[model samples]
Target chain A: MRDRKESTPSRMAAVWVRCGPAALVLCAALVPLAAPSISSYIFYLMFWITMASAFNIIFGLTGYLPFGYVAFYGVGAYVTAVMWSRLGVPIPLSILSGGVLGVALSLLFAPTLRIRGIYFAIVNFSCAMALRILVANLPEAWTGGSLGISLSAIYNPNASFYTMMALMVLTIWTVGRVSGSRLGIALRCIREDPEAAQVLGVDVVRSRLKAWILAALFPSLAGGVEAWYTAIIDPDSSFNLLITTKTIVYAMFGGLGTVMGPVIGAVSLYALDDLIWGKFPMLNLLILGLLIVLLVLFLPRGIVGTVTRRHASLRAVIR
Target chain B: MRGNSVILEVKDISKHFGGLTAVNRLSFEVQEGTVFGIIGPNGSGKTTSLNCINGLFRPDEGRIFFRGREIQGLPPHQVAKIGIGRTFQVPKIFKRISVMENLLAPVLSSPRTDQELKAKAREHLHSVGMLEMEDRLGEELSGGQQKLLELVRILMFDPQILLLDEPFAGVHPTLKTLFYKKIHELRKQGKTFILVSHDLTSVYALCQQIIVLDQGEKIAQGRPEEIKRNERVIEAYLGR
Candidate 1:
C-alpha cells in the first residue's frame, strides 16, 4: 500500500477544464423537457458538489476542522436573495456578490484561523450557530427572518443547472490548479506540522488564512444557486448544520486531500440519497453519520487510501 | 567583521519562554563558505537559535541578517524566499510524500519546471545513493536514509548556507562517515553550513570554527582544538 500512488489521471483531471461546461449546458438544454423530480435532484447534487469541494480545501487537505462553513453558505443564499428580490439585481450579479460575501466572511474568520486541531473546529461550529441565530433575530422585513424571502423564480431549470454545473466545474479546476501549485505544498506542510513548515519557509498562518477565504467562496456561491432554485429560504434551512456536515462527509468519503475526492464522494452519497432517501428521508443523514463513522474507523485514509492499500496488498502477495 | 564576508549573522538574538530564557542574547556570524558547529549540552539553545534565524521564533531581542539583509522578525516562508534552507533535528521528512517528491517540494515559486527539478532531484537522490528508492515513501526509509533524504531536500533550495540540526543523529556508523564525506564535498565547493550537534567528535572533525553555547549564552567561540581545551566547556559538560 505504501508504494501505491494515486496517479491523478490527466484525462479525468482535464474533464472539467475541457468539457464540463459543455456537458452541463447539454444537460441543462434537456432539463426543460425532462421530469421535474429528476431535474430537482440533479440541480441539488450539482450545486452541493461545489460546496463540498470548497470545504475539502480547508477541512480535508489542511485538516483544520470547520463548523462555520455553512455560515458562508447561508451568507451566499441571503445575499443572493436580498439582492435579487429587493434590490432587483440580476441573477449573475447577485451570485457574484455572493462570492464576494464568502471572501469577506473568510477574512473575518482569520483571527480564529490561528487556532489548530479541535479548538479551531469548535470555533467554526460556534460561528455557524451564531450566524444562524443572528439571522433568526434580524428584522423580518429585511431578511424576511422566520418567513425568509420569496424571490422571483427562475422557471428555466436549464439555466439554473447549467450555471450550477459550470460553477462546480470551475471550482474543481481552480482547486486542482491551486493544490498542484506551491500554495498546496504549503497547506499540506501546515497540516502536518505548522512549526516545521514555518522553519522550512512556509508561512503557516498566512497560507491557512488564504485557504480559509477560498474555502468560503464556493459554499456561499452554492448557497446563492440554492436560493434561486428553491425560490425562497429561511435561516434554519440556509444555515443548517446539515450543509456543513454533508460537505465534510462527502469529502472524507471520496478522499479528503485528493482533488477529486469531493466530487466522487458527492456523487456516490447523493446517488444513495436519491435511491432510498424518499422512503426514509432521515436515512440521508443517518447514512452520512454512519458512513463517516465507519470510514474513520476502518479506513482512516478514505476511498483513495483504501484503494491504494488494496493495490499494495495485491502487489505484496504477487511478490 | 570587515575582514570576513558574513552571509548570515545572528545579532544578539534572545528568546524568552515566559520567565525562563531559552536563548539568551546569543550572537554569532557564519562566513559565506565555512562549516560552523554549535556544540552545547542538552537544553543549551542550539535548536532555538536556528528557529529564530529561520523565522520560526521571533526573538525577544535582536535581528538576524541573511545575505546582508534583515530577516529576524520576518516569517519563515519569506526567509525561505530570500534563500535559507534547513533540516530538522529528527528528520521532518513528509512521511507520506515520496523521496524524490520531498526534494521537489521546496520549489515554492514554481510548481513544475519538469526536467530541471526532476533531473536535480534524481541527481540528489543518486548522491545520497537513494535514487533507486526515489519513489519510496519517507516513512519506509531507515534512520540513516531519512538524514540523507533531508540533506538532498535542503540542496533543492541551493541555499547559500544550510542550517542542519544533528545531521548525524541516529544514523549508522558507515552512513555517518558517508554523510560527513558529502558535507566535505559541499564545503570544498564553497557551500556554507550551520551544524548543531552533541557529537563533539563529529564537530571537531568537520567544523573550522566552533561556538559552545551554555545555559543559552555563548560560553566559548574559537577553533575546535581551543574549545576542547577550554575549562568552561569542560565545566559545562562535566562540573568544575
Candidate 2:
C-alpha cells in the first residue's frame, strides 16, 4: 500500500539519495576510480554525513537544537581511543564501546532534553564547551590530552575509508526508516508542543531522551572509525566541534525534518568545503560564514526541502 | 476501558502558584457515560484543575482517581493510555506536520495496530468532515478546522474520557451548529466528556451535570437547570 503517513510525494525533483546495499555497492565501485588517499577523505565525509543525519533525528524531529553535540562526539572518540589504545581491544568492540560511552554521557545531560528552544540549546552548548575544556586539561597518558592517540592498522586510509562510508550509509538508512515509523511522529509532536504531545499520550521526556541517545551513536561511532582511519587521535582531532557544527548546518541546509535534506546537505557542504578551502585558505571561513547566513535567510527550507516543495506544486499543476 | 460508572474522581485538588491560588480543594466525579461540564469566570482554576487531573501539574494538595485508580500525578501520556484524552484552549497542533500525520501521531505512538488505528482515525476525521484536510498542515487550517482536527485527532485513540478545554471559543459564528452536532454525535458513541468552557449556553445544552467554579472554589454543582437558577452561580456569572 502507498505510505499514507505522507501523501504521495509529488516528484520532489527526483534527486538521488544513496542508501542500503546500493550505497555500499556504489561506494565499493567508486573506490577503484578514486586515488588511494581519497578513501580517507571519503571516510571522513561518510562519518560526517551519518552524524548529521543523527543530529537531524533529534534537532530536526524535536525542534530542540543541541549546540553541544560535540561533547558526545568527543567523549565517544576518547572512549574508543582508551579502549583500543590502552587495552588493545578489537576495533569492533572499541567502536561499540564508544557508542555505549556516548549513551552513558548522554544520560549525564539528558535532562536538557526537557527544556525547549534557546534554553535547551544553551545548556547543550555550555556542556560541550565544558567537555572540551575538561578534555584539553587532562594529561597525555590517560587520553593523549591535546596530542591525542593513534593506532596503525585502524588508521589505514583505504580500509578505514571504506568502513566509514559503510557506517555513514547505515546511519542514514536507519534514520530514514525511523522517520517513516510511528516514533518519528511522536518526535514531531514533541517538537511542535511538549504539553500537547504529553496530552496526546506521547511520553515527551522519554521520546526526547531516545532521540538524544540515538543522535549520539553516530558521532561516537564516527570517532572510533576516525581514530582507526587517521592512525592518530588527539582531543583536538577526536572531539572537533566541526563534527557537530557541520552536521547541524548540513541538516538545516537540507530540510530539518525531511529524510533526504541532511544527506543532500552533507554532500553539498563537502563540495563547498573542497572548492573554497582548496582554492584559498584564508577566505575559507568567510565563505562558510556567508553561505550559512545566505542559506538561512534565503532558503530556510534547506536545499532539498526547498527543491522538493517547489517541484511538488509544479507537478501538481502538471498532473 | 473503565466500566459504565463513576470513571473518575477528583478530591480536594489544590494548586497555588506561590501566593496566587490557581485551583483550590476542588472535588468532582465524571460519570462513565455522561458529559461533565466545568464552567466559571476566567482564572477560576478551571484549566488548572484539568491540568492537575491530566498530570500537567502536581497539585500541592489533593488527589485524582481515574477508574478507581490514582491518576493525579501520573504522567499525562500514562493518564491518556488509561483512556483519558485532552485538547488545549488554543489548538496545539504540529504546524509543520500534515493533517494525516497529525492524526497518525497519536495512533502510531499508542499500542494500537496500524490498520485498526488508521481506520479509526479516518473514521473520526470523516465524522468531523476533516478527512479532506488530512493532507493539509495543522497551521494551514482555519480556526474552526483546527478545532475539528484537534477533536478528531484525540478521537483516534478512542479515549473513554475527553477533556476539551474550549472546543468553540474562536470558531466562526456560523459553524456553531456544526460543532455542537459533532459533539452530540460523539457522545452517542458512548465516550465520556470533561468539557471546560465559559459558553454556558452550549454547556447547558450538552451537559447533564454541571460544576461551577469561581475564584478557585466550587461555588455550585447540580443538573444544568439547577445550576442555571442557583443563587451563587447566577451571582458568579452576573456578579449581582
Candidate 3:
C-alpha cells in the first residue's frame, strides 16, 4: 500500500504500481465473503477513500482548500434519504439524484471561486454551516428536522458496502486519469499561480469551476451510500466537520496531488484510527491534532511526496 | 506583412490602487511588427500600464483597443485568448511541474493532439537550447532559466502581441543576447511587442518607438535618439 516501502527494488515497485489498483479493488470486493464481521470497517474505509480522492481534485490540483466540503456530502445524504423514503424513488436513482443535486449546489457556490486562499476557505465553511442550520430548521414533515429521516427498513449492509467500494474505485480511477490529462495540467498551473496561468492563456476561472464540480460529485455519492448503509441520515452526523478534517488529513498524509496518495492515506490512517483511537475516544482528537502538527513540521509533503522527492526514479513508478 | 497600421491603442487609461495612481491618462499606440519600449524608474507605472493592456488590472478610466476591439475591462485569460501574452517581473513558472508541462499548460485549449503539442514543445525548447531539460521540474531551473522558460512558454502559444516585463533583469549575458536575437527574429515574423524595462541600452537597441514614464505619467515619447536628447527623460532617470 505504501508503494513497496523505501527499500524495495525498483523492478518490484514498478510491478506493484501497475497491479496495485486492480488488487485493491479485488480485495475490497471480496472482503464480505472473506470476513463478514469486518464489513462495517471495510465500508468506512471505502467511504474515506472516495471522500479524500474526490477532495484532492480541487484542493490538490486547483489549490482550493474547501473547508465546507461536507456540505455536498450532507446534501447528498439528505437528498437520497428523502427521495427514497418519501418520494418512493428507486435506490440507485435516489443516490444518482444526490450526485446531481450536489453539482447543482456547486454551481450555486461558484461565485466563491472569485476569492482565494484562507478567505475562500472561511466563506466556504460559513456556507456549509448555514446549510446545516437550514436543514435543521426545515419542516420535519419534509426534512425530518433534527430528528432526521430513517430508511432502516430497507437497509442492506452488503448492497451499500459494494456500492461504496465501486465508488471508491471510480474516484481513484478518475483522479488517475485527471492527473495525467490536459485539464489536470491547467488546474495545476492555476494552483501554482493563478494570475500567471491566466496570462499564459489558461482559463483560470473555468478550470477552477470544473475541478470544483468534480470535487463535489463523488463525496455526494459517498454520503448517499453511507446514509443507506447506516439506515439513517441526521444533520449532525451528515454535515460533521470531522468528515472534512479526516478527509484532508488522509489526503495530506498520503500526498495531495498524486492519484494513489489519498487512497493509501485514507486506508492506512483509517486503520490506525480504528486500531488505536477507537479505544481511547477522548484521546482520539488530541492524537489526531498532534499528528497533523508533526506532519506539517516534518513531512509537509506527506508520505508519498517526501519519498518521491528523495528518490525521483520512483516518480514514474509510484505515480 | 509588416504594415503601419496601429495594432494596439491605449487611450487615456488610468489605474488607481486606493489613493495611489499607478497609471494616469497614459495613452500609447503600437504599430504592427514593431517593438514599443516603456522605460521608467522604480514606481513609474510601466508594469501597471502593461497590466492594464493585458487585463490584469482594469483601468479606472479609459479604453484599450486591440485590432479595433475594445478590451479594457476584459479578464486576463480572455485577453490572452485574444492573442495577447505577457511575462512577469519575477518568473512565475509552474514550479511543481516539468518544463514540458509548463509549456503545455498555456496552450491546453489548442486543438492539437498531445503528441503534436509535445513535438512542438520539443521544437520550441530545442530552439531555446532547453530541449535537454524538458524532464526537469521548473523549480530546479535557475532564475535566468526560469525567465527563459517563461518566455519560451509564451512563444509556444504564438500570441500576436507580447507584453514583456523586465525580460532581462537577471538573465546571463549570453542568454540575454539569445533573447535579444529572438526578439528581433519575432519582430521579423511581424509579431508586436510592448517592452517594459529599466535597461535603457536594450530599449535603445530594440525599440522603434520609446516612451519614458515618471510617476504614472508619460513624460516623453519618440525615437530612441530623441528620447536620449529629452532633458525630462534624463532627469527622470538620473534625478534633477
Candidate 4:
C-alpha cells in the first residue's frame, strides 16, 4: 500500500521532469515564427536568461555575489569592437576573442576571492566602475573613447538573435549539468561552509575560480552579440551596472541554486517589465521596485524556492 | 610504545593572535595507531594546537611533520589531501544538504562511482546508527546527531590521522559511549587519532598517552595515570 502511494506521484513527477527541458527548447525554436516584435522581445529574454544563469554559477552555487559582473560584459563588447574595427577580424572570431578576454580579466580579479560577503561585492562593484571610467578615458585612436564604437558595417540582427538563442541553450544546459554533478554538490558545500568543504578535500580556491571563469565567459559572449546586433556600443551603455542589478534581481526572484529558478525568474520578470514599460514608461521602474519589495517580503525564496519549501516532494521534479 | 614510529610530530610550534599567545612553543609526538589526548583548562590553547596541526593557521614559529613531510604552512585543503581529517569544536555539517550529502562531499574527491559512494555512505551511517536519518537535512538533526554525522562524514575520506576537537562536548551519555566504542574499533584497525577535550574522565579512559597544557604551554606528557597525578597539571587545573 505504501509502495503504491509513493510510486504514483513519483511516476507523475518523473514525466514532468523529463518533459520540462523539451518544452522549453520547443518554445524557444518556435519564437522566430511568432510576430516580429515578439521574436525580438524573446531575443532580449534569452539574453537575460543567459546572464542570470551565469550569475547563478558564482553567486548561487559558490555564494560569491559579484556586483562587477557587468564588467565582463563590457569587456566583451569592447574586445569585440577592437577586434572587429581595429584589427579587421571577422565578427564571429571577434566575439570568441571577447570571451577569452573576459576569462583573462576574471583571472586578474582572482585575488578578490579571498574577501568574503559584502566586501567582495563592494570590491567587485568598484572594479566595474573603474573599468567603465578607464574605457571612457582611453585614447580615441583605439577604443573610440566616450564616443564608443559603431559596427553597423557588419550589423545583422538575425545572426545576433540566433547566436543568443544558441548561447542561452548552452548556458541552461551547463547549469543543469552542474546542478546534478558532483562538482555542483561540492560547490554547494562550499557555499554552506568553506572550512568544512576544505576539510572534505575540495580545492576551494580552484573550484571557485572554475565557476567564476565560466560565469564570466557567458556574459561576455552575450555582450559581444548585443554589441553587433545594436550596431552601437558606448562606455556608459556597454558597462551599465543596471544590467548586473537586473540579472541579480531575476535570479533572486526565481531562486538562486536550482536549475529552473533563474529561467522562471528571467522569463516572468522580463514579460512583466515589457508590459509595464511599454504602457507606462514613467511608472515602470516604480512598479517594478514595489513588486520586488513585495516579493522579498512575502516570497524571499522566490517562486521555485517557495513552492519546493511547501512541497518537498516537488524538488526533484522542479529542478 | 616508546619505540613506535611517530605518525605526527609537532616541534616547538607557537601561534599568537596579536599580543595573545594562543599556543606557545608546544611540542609533542603521537605514535602510529594510538588514541592520543590533549587536555587543558578553558583557553589553554588546546584548540589552537589542533588548528596549527591541520593548517587552519600557520604557527608563528616551529614545524609540523606528518609522516616525515613538512606540512607547517600548507593550506587546509592541501593538508586534507595529504591524509589528515578534522572535526571542528562546533560541528560543521552542511546544513542546507541531507545527511547523506554531507557524507558524500568528501567521498566525491575519490574515484568511486555514485553507487559505490552511496553504499559506503550508508555503511558509515549504519555504523553510527544514523542510517535512518540519511535523508534528513543536517540542520534538522539534534546537536549530538550533527556531531555524529560530522564524524561519519570525515570517515568517508579514510584519512590516516584524525583530529577530533571536543568530540564529547554536550553529547548525551549514550552517544559518548558509542563514540568511545567507535574510537576503540578504529584504533584496533590501526588508525591514529588526536583528541582534544576537557572531559577528563573520558580522556583518562580512552587515551593511551596524554598531554596536559596550561596557558599555552605543555606542563606534562605521559600515560593518563601520570597526567592525572602530575603536580603541575594539578596546579594548572586547581589554580593553586
Candidate 5:
C-alpha cells in the first residue's frame, strides 16, 4: 500500500503547477493597460473573460448551463445603481453590495435546481425576461422604470477599467481554486451523474448551489463596474440577453472546466467581434453563428479541451 | 456471520411507477457481518428493493431501518453519510475524471486531510490491483476495470453496509473470484452486504440467507439449499 501522507514538497509543487500560468496571464493583462490607445478594448476583453469564467463555474464544473445568467448581472447593476443614487452609497461599496445582491437574487431562483437539463435553461431564461419586464414596469420613483439610472457624476472609465482588470484576475483565481478543491471534484461528479455522486456521499444540491452563487457573484461585480463605466443604464441594456449568449459562446469557444479556457475564448472572440462589429454590422451575427457552428461540429471540446486531449502532459500545466 | 443482531430491516415496503408495481410489500432483515443475497428474474424488483434500501427511491409504503434508525425517504447522500454505500447496476463511474479522483471523492467528504485521503485512495486502488491505472480517466477503463474501480471507490467511505447491484455482471472470471474474496474479507471485518446478482452459483455459495422475488413480490425466503428446492422459486425462475 502507498503511504497515506502526502509530503509537503509535493503539495507545494501542485500549487505551483496550477497557479503559475494564471500569474503569468495576469501580468500580461496588466502590461496591456499601459497602452491608452486600446485601453477600452482591453477593458472589454477583461469584462468578457471575467463574465465567461464566472459562467463556467456552474456550466462547465457542474454542467448547469444557466441561460439566464445575465439576470444576476442586470440585478447587480440595478442594485448598485439604486444603492448609489437613492441611499448615496459610495461607488466601491455599492459595487460590493451588487455582488451580495447577485447572490441573493440567485437564491430566489434556487428552487429551479430541482428541474434538470434543458428545462432548467428554459425556466431560467424566462425568469430573466420576467425580471427585466418587472423592472421596466415598476414605479418610476424607486427603479426609474424604463428610463433607467444615470450616474454621470461617478463615471470614470479608467477607474472602472482598473477595477474590472482586478475582477478578471480574481475570477481566474477563483476558478483555479475551485478546480483544484474537493468541491470541484464533487461538482464534476454531479455533472457526470447526480445519483451516483449522491450515493458516493456528495451533497449534490449544496455543491451546485455553491457553484451557482459563485457564478452569480462574478457577473454581478462585472455588471456593477460596467454600469459605472457607462454612467447610464436602461432595463434593455442592463438585462441584455446578448450578454448571456456571448458569455456562453466565449466559454464554450475557449473550453469549459479549465482556468485558461474562458480567458482564451473571451480574448480571441471578443477581439474578432470588435474588429467586425463596426464594419459589417449585419454580417457579424452571421459570422459568429457560423463560427459557433463550426466549433460545435469540428472542435466540440474547444481549443484547450482539444489540446489537452491530444497531449497528456499539458493537461496538468494548462488546467 | 459473526453477529445475530439485525443491522438493516425493511418492513413491507412498496414502490410503484404509474400502473407498474416495481416492488410490492417486501420485507427483509439483514444481520450484521452477513452476505444476504437477493435474486429474482428480470423485472422482479431486486434492483428496486436495493434502491429503496439505499435511498435512491423512496418507498411508497413501509419503512427501512438501518442500525435501528429509519432511513427510508432520506436522500442518497444522507444515507451514504449514515454508512450505507452502494454501487449501480451499470457501474456509473465518473467518466471525465481520473481513477485516482474517483477513489478520492468519497473520502474527501469525510473529515480527512488531503494527504491522508490521497494515501487512502492510493491504498484502496492498489488493493484492487488498479494502482497502475490510477491516473487514467474513468472511461478509459475496461468494463471489468470500471466495476472494480466502482467497488473500491465506495470502499473508500468505509461503509458499514454495502448494497452492490450486480457487481459480477460482465466482469471477468478472475475478477469475479477476486470480488467474491473481497466481499468475504469485508464480511470477516464485520461489514454487512446486500448483494443483488443473477450469478446463481456465487450467490448460493456466498449467502447464508436468500430471498426470491417474482413479478415484484417475494415468493420465497430461506437458506440457499431450501430456496433451491422451493417450488415457487423453481416456477419463478423457469416460468409457470
Candidate 6:
C-alpha cells in the first residue's frame, strides 16, 4: 500500500506536462519583444495573474476572502512612489520596500483572521477603505495629497512590463509550491475545519499568518510595478475597489484552491474583458457582471474546480 | 501522576458560554493505559468536558493536569503537541483534502522525512482497511469510513492520551466492534483514552472505570457495574 503510486500518466501526457508550462511562460516572456503594441496589455495580464494567484494563497487555500486586497497594492504603490520620487531611492529597492511594508500591514491585520467568513471580508474591505481615506489626507509634500505623485521622470513601460512578467512567474511558482507542500495541506485542513486542525497539532493561527504574509508580498510588488508602468500613483486609482473585485472574480472564475485555476482564469477573463472593451465598451461591465452571475449560479467551483470535481481523472492533469 | 500511574487528572474544571454553564466543576481521573468512559444523556456536558480536557475551550475555573503538568488554558494544538489528541462527534476530517493529506496535516512538523510519514500514514490506513482510499477526498468517504479515517489520523500523531467524543455514535455495529478492538489494542500498547458517549453498551464493555454526568455535574463515578447499579444515574439518564 505504501508503494502505490498516485497514478501513472500516459507517456504523451507526461511529456506535455513537462513542456506545457515552460513553453507558455517562454511565449509570455517574449511578448514585449514579439509585439510591443500589445506589451502593455500583456503587462496587465501578468499583473492580474500575479494578483489573482497571490489572492488564491489566502482566499483559496485558507478560506479567506479578502475583499479589500487592494490595500496592499495601494500601499505598495504609495511606498514605491514616495521613495523613488521624493527620496530618490532606486526603482528595484523601492519596489522591495513596498513589498516589505505590505507584509508589515498584513501582520497588523492579523487579528482579523480570528473572525471568519463574511465578517472577515467586511472588516478587510473597511480596512482598505480607511487606508485609502488616510492616504488621501496625508501631507501634500509626502503623499501628494489627493493630487497624487508622478514618476513620469523615470517612465519606462518596457522595463516595468518585464518586471511584472517576472513577478507573475515568481508568484505562480510560489503558489504552485505551496499548493503541493505540507503547508498547503495544513492550510486546506484549516480551511475545512480549523478546530479539528487545531486538535490534530496543526498550528492554525500561525499557519494562516504565513499564508497572509505570502499573499501580501506579491500584490504589493505588483502595485509598485504597475505604478512604475503608469508613472503615477494616486490613492483613488491605487486603492480602487475594482482592483479587489477583478482579482477576486478572476480567481473565483478559474477555481479558488487549485494551482492552474487562477492562471487559466486570469488569462481567459482578461482576454474576454479586453475583447468586450474593444467591441462593446458600454456593455463591458454589464457583460462581465452577467458572466459572474452565470459563473456563481452554474459553475460555483470555477472552471478548474468544477471540472476536476466532476471528472476525477482530470484532477492530476489540470492541477 | 497521583501514583505515577494516573495519566490524566481533571480538577474541578468548569466551562461557561455566556449565561449557560455547560460544564460545572467537573472532575475525574484516568489511570495510565486504561479505557475511561464519560457517559451522559444529551446536553449533559459530555462533549463540553472532553472539549475542556483537549483545550478546545478553556475552563472558566480549575486546573487540568496531564501527567502532572498543569495544562488548562493552552491552545488545542499546544495541547496536542504536549501529547493529547481528540476527535469530534461528527468526524471532522478535512473534507476537501485527500485521506493521505488529512493524515499528514497534523504531523507536518515531525522530524521524519515526507517518505517516512507517508509510509507510516499508509501503514495506519492499512491497519484500519483504508489504505485503498488514501487518495480519495475525505468527503468522498462514507460516514463510517470518515470516522475510521479520523481515528487513524489522530493515531498517526501517537498521542499518549486521546479524547474521543462520541466515537461510537452512528457507527455501524461491525465498525463499533472494530473500534472496541482498536481501543483494547491501544490500551495494551499503554495508550490512555477518555471515550465520551451516551452509547452506554460499548462504554460499559470497554471502560475500566466510568463517570456519569448530568446537567454539567458529575452524578456518579465507579466501575461499569457500579455505574450500572447507581440509582442516581438510572434516574438522571438510564431510566425509561
Give one digit per residue, the lDDT tens place, for model 1 in B1-240.
Answer: 123488888888899999889999898888877889999999999999988988888999998888778888888777876778888899988776557656766765555564677788888888878888876667779988988988888788777678899988888899999889999888877788899998888999999889999889999999989999999999999977
lDDT of 2 by residue, A1-319 (tens): 1143322453432222323336555866487468865664566567768878888988888788888888777887788778888889987788889889888888898877767789988988898888888888887787876777767756566666677777777887778777767788888888888888888888888878888888888887887777776677776765566667777888888778877778778777887887778898899878877878988899997876666455543222111
List where candidate 5 sits over 4 angstroms from the true fold.
Answer: A1-37
Determine which window of 10 residues in candidate 1 chain A has minimal summed lDDT: A310-319
Highest DockQ model number: 6
Pairs that collide in candidate 6 are none
Q: Which ten residues in a row have the lowest lDDT in candidate 5 chain A?
A: A1-10
- Give lDDT tens digits, candidate 3, residues B21-133: 99889999999999999998999999999999998899999999999999999999889989999998999999987798999987899999887888888898988898988
Whichever of 1 and 2 has more TM-score, that candidate is 2
Mark the 10 consecutive residues where model 4 chain A has the least summed lDDT. A1-10
| Model 4: interface root-mean-square deviation in Å | 4.3
- Give fnat of each prediction, in order: 0.50, 0.79, 0.82, 0.66, 0.77, 0.95
Ranking by TM-score: 6, 3, 4, 5, 2, 1
Error of 4 at B71 (Å): 1.6
**Residue range B1-240, candidate 5, lDDT tens digits:** 466899999999999999999999999999999899999999999999988988899999999999899999999999999999999889999998778878887866677787788878888888888888876778889999999999988999999999999999988899999998899889988999898999999899999899999989999999999999999998889887
Docking class of 5: medium
Full ranking by DockQ: 6, 5, 2, 3, 4, 1
Cα lDDT tens digits for candidate 4, B140-191: 8999999999888888888889999999999999999999999998888888
Question: In terms of docking quality, how is candidate 4 classified?
Answer: medium
lDDT of 1 at B105: 67
- A1-319 per-residue lDDT for model 4 (tens digits): 0011233555676676678767876887877778879878988999999999999999988899899899999999999999999999999999999999999999999899999799999999999999999999998988998889999999788788889988898999998888777888888899899988987788899888988898999999999988988888999999988899889889989998877889889989999999998999999878878887888898777888777766666655665
| Candidate 6 lDDT over residue span A1-319, tens digit each | 1223435544454466568778977887778786665887888999999999999999999999999999999999999999998899999999999999999999999999999999999999999999999999999999999889999988998899889988998999999888888899888988898989999999999999999999999999999999999999888999999899899989999999988899889999999999999999999989988988998998888988887777665565666
Model 4 ranges off by over 4 Å: A1-10, B1-3
Candidate 2 chain B weakest lDDT stretch, 10 residues: B105-114
Which residue pairs clash within candidate 3?
A: none
Interface RMSD of 3: 3.8
Chain A accuracy as TM-score for every candidate: 0.87, 0.89, 0.95, 0.94, 0.90, 0.95
